[model samples]
Target: MSDGNAKKTSSKESFLPQIFYNALLVGIMAGISWYAQKHSVTAGEFVGAFASIPLPVVLFAMVMDYLFDTGSLYRKVAGKKGLTGAITALGVAGFFFITMTWLVAGTITMNFSTITPVIYVVAGLLTLLLLWPKTGTTHFVLLYYIAVQLITKFAHFTLLGGVSLG
Candidate 1:
């Protein structure tokens, strides 16, 4: 029974090793975003590159933070391990937000540096809600993917949304 209980525990033991892997991937992606900010030539070019990444991660995380539950609410929170996982997930989500927001801002206009921060400021504000205990998602792999999409959707509107890849 103890083994079964341990298995049922979410976001802790299973996720710890994964944190390093995901963090490394996120770090690489962040570097790519920085590269895009500094090196990309035109808004259209940037748009194409930005749109190339799979996304809408933000919307998923929002749902997880607010609406997602495995009927696991009855179980006690997973203590420090769970907190670590959530915080790591939060950081992972943050990188996704920054990278995609920067990319999407580039899609809107080449003068993205000035506006990117402002856009994600709102994103950051919205992300704060994840602090609530409601965000007990078991899967960080998808959250990792969803973060980029969230920021993309937030800033897209018509400007970046319809960016012609031609």
Candidate 2:
């Protein structure tokens, strides 16, 4: 390949790792915040909660989230091409469906009775409608992931006063 082509490929490869790193960082921060909120009995106990979470659990959650987001994006963009693609798409969709169900159920148990699992399912379907033409670009996936996280956290705070473990 020409030097110009090589440079382009290298740049593209470099961009993916950066995104992965950023996702990992975000996941860790979210995990720590979740731990603090769940374990604290008072404001003073919040800081101590960080040290108590097992490192493996934090890493696992972050890694799982990162992989799920990546896989979902891949399925959205390329999973219509062949049999493998179809299987991958199905797997990714199934995983997200289960995850959203659990999230909705958990949030509901935290006293957010008005927010049902159907709402989350509908929101996800709407997002898919918006993303269909866009082909699941990395930028779009990242933004969507962050938005979901923020919304989930906000709901937790609003409904439970950020104190109760759901």
Candidate 3:
């Protein structure tokens, strides 16, 4: 590729999004504690901090897959049969968490436990949504997952720390 194109591509892939995400996560943690203090004495700062952990959460999900016979994730979910639906849901959620973790950590020091609760809530919701009696439409499942992800993350920040996203 030409030097001009390379430069343009590099500029487009700037670290703005990554920096923004980190700031947002930290803000959420602080907000969770502040919000909780309004109602109760404890700010729930620990919960907020723990919610930021991602490795353990991903690890637990992997273990769950092994125990539940979620082998060959691709084949099982390709046809959307039986437990395959649930497996697919888990795989997608897992991938998101893992990607988010790597983006934030990026070889720097990190506190894994800080994100566990958030991941736990997300994975739990995904599992439940996948297991629920299907409406025969995958669209609903995907929508449900997205909705749950937003709601849970919001609640984790607000209720736990009184933190506001905006």
Candidate 4:
């Protein structure tokens, strides 16, 4: 390629869009919080500064997963056809996610002991949404995952007040 074309391409592919996305995430959260507090809406609860990850971090992780993942674990269970086999696969996937979440969270929540089973199933299904070959590795799935985080936090703050499930 010509130097002129390369320079044009680089200029067109500037970091502004990524910066906009990051700004949008922060702005949405802050706006929701501000509106809720100003209106005397119930602040759900403070999960923690560490409860959820930011959009940029999750986006970076998705890129890394796309580049480096072997898909061995996903492949192992994703091929099951029988109902019982599928259920087992779901359970295993759920267990793996919950354990990872716990490890990352570091501090245990007050409600952990009481709701382990429910959370396990939900988390499993969610993980599978991205693990399924038809959907998991797609560019849109990563965007959807981060979008979910954004919407969820917005809902929690706007409706429940500060956090979720308060």
Worst 10 residues of 2 by lDDT: 155-164
Candidate 2 residue-pair clash tally: 0
Please give, for residues 23-56, the per-residue lDDT of candidate 2 as tens digits: 4335444543554455443432322222222333
Q: In candidate 4, which residue pairs get closer than 3 Å at backbone N, Cα or C atoms, i.e. clash?
A: 43-161, 43-162, 44-160, 44-161, 44-162, 130-136
Query: What value of lDDT does candidate 1 attain over all alpha carbons?
Result: 0.44
Better of 1 and 4 by TM-score: 4
Off by over 4 Å in 1: 1-61, 64-78, 82-90, 99-112, 135-160, 163-166
After TM-score superposition, the amount by which residue 40's alpha carbon in candidate 1 deviates from its true location, in angstroms, is 28
Please rank every candidate by TM-score, starting with the best: 4, 1, 2, 3
Error of 3 at 27 (Å): 2.5
> lDDT of each model, Cα atoms only?
0.44, 0.41, 0.40, 0.43
Using TM-score as the measure, the top candidate is: 4
Please write out the lDDT profile of model 4 over residues 1-166, one tens digit for every residue.
Answer: 9999999976654444334433433544455456445544432222222124344434543553453235665444433434444565547645645543343233346667553332333233334443434443676535654455565664422211122331
> Model 1 over residues 1-166: C-alpha lDDT tens digits?
5887877775466566455445544554565456545554454444333333334434444454544234442122222244565565556457645554544443444554555433443334334334333444644424543454355563432332333222
Candidate 3 residue-wise lDDT, 1-166, digit = tens: 9999999976654444334433443544455345444435332433343333343443443444443334454334433433444455446645644544443233213555554343333333334333222322344433433454464574432222222222
Superior candidate under lDDT, 2 versus 4: 4
Which sections of candidate 3 miss by over 4 Å?
1-12, 43-166
Best by lDDT: 1
| RMSD of model 4 against the true structure | 15.7
